[model samples]
Target: MRALLLSLLLGAAVLPALAAAPTDPPTPPVPSTTDGLIAQPWYRPHHLIGQVAGGQGMVTVGVGYTTLRGRLDVDVLTGYVPRKYSITPMGIFTGKATYSPWTLGLGASRWQVRPLSVGGLVNYTASRGMNASLDGKYPKGYYWWPARSRAGAFVGGRVAYELPTKANGQPRTASLYYELGTNDLYLVSLYSNIKALSVADILTLGIGVKVDL
Candidate 1:
């Protein structure tokens, strides 16, 4: 009887010790490829953009992606020009890419400044009333470029104000920028009439805003 009782007590003690003993913590789960892409989806745009008169259209609005530590912005925009400005009301679609080499933050202020920004854009305008530059009436090589498509380059600066952080802990910002640009056609005209055409004559002014999403 005593032996049976002692054996039961020993068994209880040993079972508790074994239960309390810690095993190697489960190996942390290896992050899968799907987990890595959750931070930024391919279809998500980083910000929204709107602009006026960069030779794109009278008013342009679009979505954009901010990459390269905010130094690069790629935007796709659509714009409209009133009939008063052209033979007919026109719709313009533009793809633009801008790069700013440096960004300076103001001393303890939310304001920031980008001293230099350079970019290029390609745009297509659709209008029924506009005559085609390279039509059957003209020889194949007579007109070197299409009337509806334009390519341009610009240089500018930007001023931005930091906004409150979002619920997801993402920072937000709003920026205003300006671009002075010239289109390929304008550049060609300047090249042909260097004495008559001034740099200011060919330049187009554009102002825009960007808001983080």
Candidate 2:
């Protein structure tokens, strides 16, 4: 009778212990909100870009960063123009920013359209033979604008095709874009001779491509 009572008591204790133990898997720890942003290195660019003919150079290549949910892109580019196009071979360094207010998705397709894009650029041209505004050859105030530097604004559009997402779930894309732009010098000339110089005469067209990293 003593042995039997001992076994029963043990059984009762084990039954309650087993019932209290968890059956379901432990809940996973939640991810921190800033984990994704903090994981990315600051020097890593969001995209790589290349372009042709926008008064910057005959050919330009660069890297860019995308922000504000891909609505804004800021880029830095290095451009080259052969001697055939200038007195000497010229290298152009440019910094630009582009903003696209809207993105429209094509129905059930990977294509996306940015119907309007507005941007501005500033560039400095370096060439051995190029005249500098501050050079002794030009008297003070003789030229109001810097000959080797130019600032411009453009309006353009882009079409992007989305690719597979990265391991981290960031989307990838390839895009083709076009820009119509004019420089400050061109604007000044146009203003001085509005009747003789039409908007088309001062406009420059640039074509380019961008690939998301």
**Per-model lDDT:** 0.89, 0.90
Off by over 4 Å in 1: 1-38
Question: Any idea what lDDT model 2 has?
Answer: 0.90
Give each prediction's root-mean-square deviation over alpha carbons.
Answer: 10.3, 9.3
TM-score of 2: 0.82
Maximum-lDDT candidate? 2
lDDT of 1 by residue, 136-167 (tens): 99977998899999999999999999999666
lDDT value, candidate 1, whole model: 0.89
TM-score of 1: 0.80
Query: Which residue window of length 10 is worst by lDDT in model 2?
Result: 30-39
Say which candidate scores most in TM-score.
2
